[model samples]
Target: MVFELSQSASDALWLETHQQFMPVTSADGLETISKIPPQLGKGYEREVALQPGVELHIFDSTYQDIAIHIPENQHPVQFMVYVSGVADSGDFIYQDANWGYVGGSGIQTPVRTFFPGAQHQVGVIVHVQPHLLAQLFGNSESKLQPTLDVLVPGDEQPQQVFSSPTTGAIRAVVRQIIDCPFSGVTKRLYLQGKVFELMALQLEGISTPVCQNRMLKPETMARVQQAAAILRSHLETPPCQTTLAQRVGVSDRTLRRGFKQLFGTTVLGYLTEQRLALAERLLRDTDLSVTEVVHCCGYSNPGHFAAAFKRRFGITPRQCALGVISAQS
Candidate 1:
């Protein structure tokens, strides 16, 4: 399939292409599910309005090659997470396990191509109103980072695009959203919570310092990456900083400096982030109890685990498991 259309006109095009395909809409009209025409592919696409200003698009299908051209025009802020398949969008490439952000105005026309095959193209796209985004990020007196500044643009701001590999935390949330089991109003409420969770994660990921390890020697960068791997592999009982440095064939000082330069955080910071992320996945996806999750993720005290979990995710471990959204969240 090949077509050129404004991003806003995409659904109309889909309807035109599959005249026989009837969309199934919820009673409240907040959710619509459409199946791909058998002649075109297998699987389905879902559109859900999580709220008045936030919309979610979930696509999961194996289709023949498809190309879409989006012309220069204003666009609402979008956060996209691709789980599989390759989509080349001009300067930005979207592939398995990656995320991308698009916002601002006057974007150049980009021809996004989806390769042909049996592979499933699974992904979630969240469209947020500009004003809602601004409110979410807050109106700080201080200047926003360049990457984020472009997302909450004024009338004259230029176009912006950003992409990065999805972090474990982000992948976990995406899995939760894709696997959401509820239906009807219950499903809508569940999705609304997950959407906010995803938005928070994406914002946190983008607000971090951009990697600036280009100045580091190749060998040094390699060692730093090795240290990160060691941390991930030993989340339950990670080595001390000095020991981790030695394991990666680097001095303690070098390890610390490398982590800050390459990852924008210290070794311990990275470890804690990874641990909590793991705990979050466990709490949401597994039958593990809060206490078990605490120990599994290396927290000796359940109280401490709950505190840290709530601090990092805006909801306690138990609440996360129960799909309860706190006011703070």
Candidate 2:
């Protein structure tokens, strides 16, 4: 149940099984992630160095109840976005559909995380070294102001979790990072750009009214978030407006206003965007055909789906798929 992050993937696995950290070998350097034990449930994990001192971890899992202890190196400031499901870190419970920002130093503090079973959670974790922060801020910490400063005086300075509701802009960029259609140095550049953009969106949202509103009524916003999760869970056939509101224990008006306020989109509109985004992912990552993609995205007519797809992305699904082929070839 204890996991350590040393220098490489193999070292992490060793720490998990042996309860001790070890030197990272060349093979460990080549692989970027610790494989999730089967008993923990099915999942894929990836860790990649997008730049010196910066690593991004993407984990998508459908697991049962579990407790995991993670080592606190106190070295990197961490940022996360829970694409879905709740993340229970013994210190704080970060609910689904939120952006999390943790900046501090570490002090050998044992951190534990819990995840309930049967729910699919997609999360992106970015770890940044202080040196990289200095570089990003023009070699000065003043530019980062309060956000970059460690909360604790010493030790465990890096593990304080600051979480907030995710904005629509931040979610879109995260999807792009997860679904990037590139490899090699190009993929690194792509991911690094999205990471920067994600941070920019987080900064821009700091002063926005939506962020403030989220803080005002946590319970109500959470209900709206429930409606959102419902939509995502049933993207191909989501609940109707009234049914959704009723299910979430909110009035239709509250659901509408809250959805717009919290997510920057109406319920139906958000559903549409989610469908299209999933379509984009399928067309890019899988061998799904254009017609199948359209059907899966909840569109009955290929022509209509094609037109809307082209409008949103400036190219049809076929064209996008073709471009993937051309690039790979």
By TM-score, the best candidate is 1
Cα lDDT of model 1 by residue, 182-272, tens digit: 8878888888888888877766554443323335553465466567756765688888998888876889888988888756799988888
| Candidate 1 similarity to native, TM-score | 0.57
Q: Distance (Å) between predicted and true CA of 39, model 2?
A: 1.5
Q: Cα miss at 158, model 2 (Å)?
A: 6.6
Which is the leading candidate under lDDT?
1
Candidate 2, lDDT over the whole model: 0.64
Which regions of candidate 1 fall more than 4 Å away from where they truly are? 1-13, 27-29, 37-40, 99-108, 141-147, 210-329
lDDT of 2 by residue, 212-277 (tens): 553424345546655776676567777789998998788998888886776688888888877887
Error of 1 at 157 (Å): 3.1
- Tell me the spans in candidate 2 whose CA falls farther than 4 Å from its real position: 1-34, 71-75, 138-143, 150-159, 203-329
Local distance difference test values of all predictions, in order: 0.69, 0.64
